[model samples]
Target: MDDAYDELLLRGRVYGADHEDPGPRPGRAYRELVGGPLDGLLLDVTGWDAEALATGAALSTHLGRHGGEGRSHYEPRPTDPRRWDWTADTP
Candidate 1:
């Protein structure tokens, strides 16, 4: 499985299983990516510190360098809560 799917399982978030819409576990917070390669993917920020949460993270993606792989950089939007805006892609 890919990193994202693996992460979901690791977070105990099962889709189409016992619960129809098993959202993020209680106490788990997430930020949704608004654009770029990983758009619409929910980023779990349950335990992220203030600095890290504000700076966002470099997420992995399968679309870069001849369509092999790459990393997408995102940062929290100034006016949006629990949302990250795509900045750019990196090799």
Candidate 2:
């Protein structure tokens, strides 16, 4: 819980677990470091670098557009973004 636990706590306290902000979620690095389903799903976004930010953006967009739309996770789909409430419905 050392990695960004403070951030999560703050979010939970302030946002009450319903808020969906892409800034605080644990990245692939933490997941991989621990090794689990979380390793995936999330891209390794340790530092606030450009690549990490891009990866996060791609992850959010992909999850929202493709995953949210219920498209096959097998075949890659284009990122057709729409204004969806990720706070209530996360992909």
Candidate 3:
């Protein structure tokens, strides 16, 4: 287990697997990724019944400064006011 954990950490550091940017320190990267206004919703996974504490620690470790960089593949849609129609919004 220990060896696996160490290997994982090393891989994370090397590839910035979880946003572990090579230049910055780990704590700063973590805070930048996990913090900010959306932090509440992002961090609140209670409904998933997941292991919050352990997950947090692991994230803090493997994510380094950037926080799970390649783990997520979401791309933000282009922001165009015309794309939204407040008059007839539907789910």
The lDDT of each candidate is: 0.69, 0.28, 0.25
How many angstroms is residue 43 displaced in model 1 relative to the true structure, after the best TM-score fit?
0.3
User: Per-residue CA lDDT of candidate 3, range 1-91, in tens?
Assistant: 3575334333332213334344323322211122221221122122332343223322222222345341321111134211111111111
Q: Tens digit of lDDT per residue, candidate 1, span 1-91? A: 3587446434553212345764565555677777887676677787889999989988776663324467888899999756688888887
Clashing pairs in 2: 28-43
Best by lDDT: 1
List the RMSD of every prediction in angstroms: 9.0, 12.9, 15.9
Candidate 2 C-alpha RMSD relative to the actual structure: 12.9
Ranking by TM-score: 1, 3, 2
lDDT of 3 at 89: 11
Q: Could you tell me every candidate's TM-score relative to the true structure? A: 0.68, 0.19, 0.20
Local error of candidate 2 at 37, Å? 14
In model 2, which runs have C-alpha deviations exceeding 4 angstroms? 1-42, 47-56, 60-91
Candidate 1 structure lDDT? 0.69
- Which window of 10 residues has the lowest lDDT sum in candidate 1? 9-18
